[model samples]
Target: MDNSQKRILMAKTGLDGHWRGPTIVARALRDAGFEVIMIGMASTDDIVSAAVDEDVDLVGLNVGGHIDVAIRAIEQVQVARPGLPIFAGGTIPPHAAKQLEALGVEVYPPGSQLVDIVDAAERLTGTR
Candidate 1:
């Protein structure tokens, strides 16, 4: 698939309001030719609505709060769009990472490389 045809919805799943990580990843995705839509500090409803309304190929969540909050968003997204290719990144600890992984959400915790994220997006979105 052409990079230009790929779209990703990049979202922050907490009120933490930290942008350094998500912004960097979003930039990398954009630079790689994916149209990235960013919705900062979004709740489950916010994330789901954007994913549906935007009709993006993938959902990237930047989680920086209680895992339950992020989990809510993840579950809602999955319910809204099964197999929608949801991935996450942030200060997620090993336990939280395991939780997300069990939910089928690819977790990219701190220190994750931007290239890896874009590559994951490609693979998850079936554009690789």
Candidate 2:
């Protein structure tokens, strides 16, 4: 499948008013020819709903506040759509990154290159 056909659902799991990371990632994904759906500062329920309703191929989470919140959202999304590839970015510390990775989510910490993110999107969505 081509990049255009693949959809990525992005959500910020916290009320952290930081939209720069996800915004930049979304723009990169769009420029790379993928459909990027961004639901900024969303609740866990909203995230799961969007993931299911949008039929997205991948989920990009912008985690800021608590890791448990992100964990809850991730678990719900996995149950709602099994095997949906997920990756996360933001002010995640080392411990939280380990937790996320333990749940099979690829983690991109601060200063991760945009090309790497877009490349991961392609690899995860199988659009490469």
Most accurate candidate by lDDT: 2
| Candidate lDDT values, in order | 0.90, 0.96
TM-score of each: 0.97, 0.98
Tens-digit per-residue lDDT, 10-59, candidate 1:
88887887689988898899899999998888878999999999998899
Best candidate per TM-score, number?
Answer: 2
Please give, for residues 21-126, the per-residue lDDT of candidate 2 as tens digits. Answer: 8899999999999999998999999999999999999999999999999999999999999999999999999999999999999999999999999999999999
- Which segments of candidate 2 are over 4 A away from where they belong? none
Give lDDT: candidate 1, residue 7: 85
